[model samples]
Target: MTLELNQLSDQVQALSATAAERLASLERQRPAAEARLRAIGLADDELQGKVRAALRYRWAGAIPAAEPVDAAFPCPPHPARANVLAADGSQVYPDRHGVALYYLINVGSIAFRHGSGEAPRVASRPAVFYEDADLYEEEGRQKPVEKIDAERDRRELGELARLAAANADAPAVALLDNGLLLYFSLQAQDRAEIKRELAPYLAHLSALRDSGAAVAGIVDRPRAAGVARLLHLHTLPMEALKDHADLFQQDADFRHLTDGALFADRLQPGERSALFENGSPANLDHFQPAGHSVFFFYLNPGPAGRHALLRVEVPEWVAHDPARLDLVHAALVEQCRATGGFPYVLMRAHELAVVTVAERRELEQMVVAALVRRGLSLSVSHKAQGKAWTGAGRRRYP
Candidate 1:
């Protein structure tokens, strides 16, 4: 019995010692992990503070009220025509070597009538453009893929802008997929080059706007959306307060909370409706400063329907941040070191907006289909009823 007791005591002491060692090791690991994060370009106090402030302003429920502006032309004259345009770009990952090949897809359409009642007809085929991967050697180191993506983005946007401007007609409304104007405010090593590339497009857009036409550029994935989502999630009750804690424990449960049933049961009957009612679709506009990316969202609502635009900004910080790139490099190095080969490195853009052009089209089609589904005949057509010409000894008749 004495021998058994001694053995038991020894085992307990050994277990305690192991636990202590593990705790100390974890303590040591925490700082190292934090340092690694910092090395990967985690913002210090000032940058983080700025990010927070930007977020706060975005979700403060303080949307600015626009002062009404006088119209350029009074009514009771000729009816004005409006046009809608949207453009988006996608990148292709060519191989496992982290090479980025880019393509731009631009769509523009014209609407002849006003209000949400009339459907717009397609005016032009979606233009597809591509840019080849460019390579540059710096101190025997090739330029990073992120820089290439930024350069391509600038080039593609410039082309899209020019195309839209050329197609604009009298008293028309132009919608840009990303922002009201190209962001000349990017901080890249090739900043001047980017500006020079975009100058013509910028001038054209400015000229169009200056002419009495209402030209608006929108960035649908504005960084404000992420901040708004964060604020929204914070407003929900804690899991402990819920009757079924298990159901609300995970983020997926909260994210797929579209039905309003889970949250409804916890609140008063009327309060349940209020919780899910005022919500907008998820906003994706998150700022990746180290990556030098900005997402923006813009919306223009006329009599017919709302025109939405999405813009993504890729800046120089994506390539310049050594710490940011190091994490990627380390991951590749580790895989290569372990497996005797590394897998392809491909980075994807995080979605910044759920309401894409596809989604908008789907919604619009649904509405039109619903009318047909209810057995109503729908007809759409365009006819030139009249023609008027100004100047140059021409007959004004159609």
Candidate 2:
């Protein structure tokens, strides 16, 4: 009994010491966290006020109706044909410790002009544009394998900007598969690197806005707006949404359902969706250029779970001629077919649409075959639709 008492005493003492240390550390950090809040034009009292207001609002369960968009905008009989360019990037890496090591297997950009009836032109030369495997090492023991930090992202944006600038005088608009802002937060070193890298391109976007040239950042997901609605329903202040509480564990299940099971099947067993994290309000804030205010569109899913044509009318400053936009859409469809029926977002002067799962699988197979014919060894997994193909040592075309 005496020995047991002694052991208990020691454990109690140690726990007390640990608690004291934690309390002291928290006290020291409190002032700094508050100072950061203030520096960022926010304060504790202000935050509480917003949270209180959010709590007072009633929750609305129904999905909000989308506002009607004007599809037919008046155009001059001889509207100047604006060039449309679509760019996308793909990375491949070994699934093991090679996580951080990625082969930028492809960084392709396709450009097309209206009324040409020709296929969209490939911008990156086959040899010059593709980058070899680049090693990105992290600082600590628990480092990230995918080095999608701000610096690397910024470099990518810089390259895209240069491409756009080279063709600046071509009376064209640049289409990016992702958002304009390449980086999310500047709090971390990697994130800050991304910010620095994208700064030049953002400035160029500003110039385009001022020059009355149309440029847009197209995204396919609607969950972002859904999260925004959840925040509104919960009466959480917009500022608090920056912390992305709605994307936390409490709401993760609902958010997952929103994406539907189609894409979810593609994820590895333990892997989580990166969409919510990438499309968070905090990340979207970095897209602001002097004259450009980013606009988001929500495309509705059809009865067959396919995306019907949904139009996101561009602001007049970034609008392209309708005929030119149609040509670009046609090229995108062709590209989808070429890529093995891989579905892609179709960007038009008036709207954005989601590519169906059927189309996506078809595209993947087509692209894989093309790569095989070129003598490159390739393997593809298409389990999302309950289908997959494996190529053995021999590069046989499927």
Candidate 3:
């Protein structure tokens, strides 16, 4: 209890006031924003130029959205019978001071056949990296957490690909718990590193593209302001825009609004926004080259009054094909309806794939026991030993 409730009362009050004010502001600006979006309605030649200029000038705050977008979409009715396959991953990061120094990526997957009213098939697969080559970077350093995360993402896609292959006869939809695009940090790290990391993942995406499973990534409570950024760019004087720093430095109209908030009122239950491409370099360079450029749409999955904003990302092939896109849209809305907010398969996958603290500790003990039985003395850093002895709380009630 570092913070006392009594001490935080005034701050909490201030925060509530700010939140109410912002909510009111959002309500006020929503009309204008909708009109602005309607005005732009997929005409993005000028917006594309703005995006390119922002990239060339290294615009710090520039967000990438598809140049060609259909900013309006009506709700597609749920299909009678469709297979929903979702994959989620969890990881155990390498610990230098633990009994073993290795990382683990566990992928959990599920295939739910709606309309059949049957039980879903669920499974989990865990890959442990014990070898030096698996554990280390190209430069001989222990692989960082970001690299490990990307590996987990790759495994998630691989799991989707495997499931999609098995259920080819049925209309299948592949789901993920995150964005389809490779994270920006991985892209900025190194060209070779990004290429190496994304090669297999991109391949899986390409395979999934042709595999008949409509792959989509579902993001709950999304805060992506891509459309807001484009709207901001539209209001700017194109001729005077020289420095990218102006993007961040200027007083922008759509400062803190998210795509969700902007589209919430318009999208009723089960409805989705226009499909917009994400023009990040990672998408253009890696995924697009392989014919799987990532695109997205905002969806409202909750009831009429309580609109839950869910962002759905799909690859180029899925976006282009109406039948595939309908599968993704209807499948997601149905899944959300069953789960109340998010996809049921994704929730189950997380449960199956998660590495609990007890499991991790038990594995470490097994490692120590094996070493001891082999007559090899086990040694841990004194700092680690000291912390282990004192890490537990002295008073559970307190």
Candidate 4:
């Protein structure tokens, strides 16, 4: 057998014990985290001063907006007539051993018009890249997976922009199945690369904003510790913060605590936490200047006892405008109500975008037929051929 389950019994027992201990630790820390969050005053000039000072050291935390840090705003009334547009993207990465050196990205989108009772609009846009420039970087190296993923993300946002522009007459909320900030900056080689990657994304954000649509990036079961970091920073004295260089490191008080866990209890069913500006360097450096600084809040699109935590990220413009912000919050809650906890539109978009293995094989077969018609000899590598032949087998234990 490639892997024997019997061999993992002892390790599995130890892992279970470790998880139990971590849960105990999480329970012990939960109350203190909640208390600290509830105690912070939004207008505390001293606290804001401290956070601003800590920002200089690249502290990854949450900055308070107009709402109180402990505020739990109930879901606003959903607009009687509104548009909820969502887009999701999937990709098939290039396989070197396959018939062709090409990758494909397909984006699926849905435009659900509330109160209209009309059938929702759906679309799936697919693009295949085979050109040398599309496959290779400036130095002729094959493009990394991150670059390709960034391209998919760009297309997803661009699709949302197009959808939003077309539905500008009504109150609309455009949703993405990710964070608003593009993570490509972390892998960027230089400032130029960062700018190049962000230009198109920023332009799309502008387009969405100009189209009078509120845009948001929704993350389910988020692992972000931005709020926890803020609570940890609050515990430190100003004197210690001044002396400590790496002030953002998690201490014993709140190690491994996430914002999702922190707000799970505080936010009741169909409620959202106070908005906080993200203090990441990318937000402060590039996006903020372009007037798209990202702000996020925790939400529980719930049914009474169960907790379904989500982190909803919006730009500065949406956060400041009352109507747009309300539309985003209410539209999400209404959308989630249709599918238990998560938004129905996002689920449908993902289902439409996903590429199955059978579909991939059919695509390869079509490529082979095209080559054969042109009298060109094209075949998979020897290893790929052998693997295909032996792919199906039953596991055996030794």
Candidate 5:
């Protein structure tokens, strides 16, 4: 076997022991941490100043609320008649050794109408990019995977806007499998180009806002240590604080606990944490200006002792409004209830978006067939052919 299980046993055993010890230690410290949470208050002016200093040095960690908030508010009952709309995307990256030098992106969406008990609407759209113009960046080099992924994210939002607009009469919630903040990939992209990229999508957010639809980005099993990082900052001495490096010094103190893991025991089933705005530079710089500063809260949608913590991200408008936030919260849990602790719409959307390996090969075959019809010769790399041949074999004793 490729993994050599016998050779890895000792390492796995050591990891298991380390994990058990950490869990016990974290449990032992829970009472003190919760006490700190209760005593926490937002020192807004002072906190903002620290954030600015960190930003000056290009720190990328989450900026937390001016004060600590770990409120475990119960979930509001879902509206008897509401619509849940969700969109997800999948892509086939450009392959140099394939039948054609092209890429494809497909988005799948669902508009699930609750209360009415009617059949849900579902659809998928696939786009293939083959032209030289579509394949190349502004600098004439092949477009990177980051650009393609960003476009996919944009298209997911675009589809949500279209769906939300179509169902404007009713209360609609648009859900994405990620955050609403501008993606980190844009840091590597040109500033002007990034702004251009954001314009249309931001306009869509505005449209949703005007229509009074709630938009949320749901992250399952989130690994973010935003709040944990904030708590670490609290332990730093003032002398070392200005450097922004102090945040990392105590990172190991909470390294084993994620925001979700820490909140899992505190939140009852169907409960959510108090809203906190993300302090990331991306949110502060681009999203906030457009009234879309990203805010998030952890939710336990699963049952007691089996809490499924989800980090739900919403724009500022949704965060400030109690009714809108309730709808988003209730609808998500309700959706999860029916799908075994995960949003059913998201699962269906992903299934519809995903491109299986067999389907990809068929697409390549179609491209090859079309080229042959046009009397054009195309060749795959010999290395790729060799890999395919070797990939199909199995070891045996004779």
Candidate 6:
């Protein structure tokens, strides 16, 4: 009722028509992209040369790997007796208006024993930060949510590493409900700060690598166009790429295309696309030097008709080892088949980690009781209290 849909009917219809036109345009462009993919696969060396030259100009894109660009690899045979370990993390961000000024991170994991038909082991670990160092930056400003989210990501991978190491009896595949590359917006941060933030995450990856576990990061319906950007670079004349400034900024035919949309029809159910090395500075400059360069492939872990595309990223160690690569592919397909499209373990882990509203209210109540025991004020900010009073009601105007 607040949205006034009737007044927006014309605009909605126009938006729908624009969407339809965009789809048609994308369809017309698909064949050319596919052709370019095939052409580059036939002459990968030429593309590689171009990628090498273009790397200094751009921040992040995709670089071709050992696999042919057009290759559609079938799902490899899964291990008869393997283990699948997945971890997910959720957080309660600090609310200045609330009684407490702290954030919490909870990581949930599942250790599934394949071929034994035994029940999977699940666990969750939660930690709260209240120290000034944890809550604020050197400038005395409250730490941003992105920094906290980075910590949560680190904990998720750390949990997977711990579980993978312990469940070493069988070949283990450690899964994360995220991309292997760090997602924190580090472009604005100083080099020293960036290095400090990435240090712990890299350490955890090293742990997973040393544990002899195949690790993978699963992203459902990814909208990444890193590969598409590569294709655009391929389309440009080699001479045109010398201008590092305008090289990637130029408007192009493939601008609207996503790797998912490009590969949606190409990959059959249960098939995966060829691998591509991620060209992000974070992957190339930091992780690669540490022997953990991120590589990715698109997979359709399918039941039949539905095209549930996923981007699976792995470290250099896993990507190079045939057995580890195959296990990640096979195990992921098996996990997806159990839960329609998405991985069942990730679903369960998320469920275990998520904090519901009632639980948050209960936690706040506990905080209030503790504050009262300490003879501290048990009052929320006036703005928050006012919202609590009128949040569910509607306002009328003349």
Highest-lDDT candidate:
4
- TM-score order of candidates, best first? 4, 6, 5, 3, 2, 1
- The most accurate candidate by TM-score is 4
TM-score of each: 0.31, 0.43, 0.89, 0.96, 0.91, 0.95
Residue-wise C-alpha lDDT for candidate 6, range 192-288, written one tens digit per residue? 7767888899999999999999999999989988888887888777787777665567336775898988898999888999998999777777788
Cα distance off (Å), candidate 3, residue 291 = 1.5
* Cα RMSD of predicted structure 3: 3.1
Q: What are the per-residue Cα lDDT tens digits for candidate 3 across 35-113?
A: 8877776656786677777656544332334433435465688778888998999998998987668888899899887
lDDT of 4 by residue, 1-398 (tens): 34679999999999999999988898889998888887895638777877998998888789888888989999999878999999999999999999889999999999998888899999999999999988999898999888889999999999999999888768999999999988786566587888888999999999999999999999999999988888878777888888766485666888799998888888988899999999998888889999999999999987666669889999999999989999999998888887877888899889889989998888888888988999989999999998877777665678
Candidate scoring better on lDDT of 1 and 4: 4
Q: How high is the CA lDDT of each candidate model?
A: 0.32, 0.38, 0.78, 0.89, 0.81, 0.88
Q: Model 3 TM-score?
A: 0.89
Please report how far candidate 1 places residue 254 from its true position, in Å.
Answer: 22
- Per-residue lDDT tens digits for candidate 5, residues 243-362, read 666655656546566677678788888988877778776777778898898899989987555658899999989988888999999999899988757799999889889999999989
Off by more than 4 A, model 2: 1-80, 94-102, 117-119, 125-146, 149-160, 166-171, 181-194, 197-204, 207-212, 227-285, 289-293, 299-306, 309-398
Positional deviation of residue 362's Cα in model 3 after best superposition, in angstroms: 2.0
Clashing pairs in 4: none
lDDT of 2 by residue, 84-149 (tens): 555555433322221122232234564555445566555432111112323433442322423444
| Candidate 1, superposed: residue stretches over 4 Å from native | 1-80, 93-133, 137-168, 181-184, 187-201, 210-212, 225-398
Which consecutive 10 residues in model 6 have the weakest lDDT in total? 185-194
RMSD of 6: 1.8
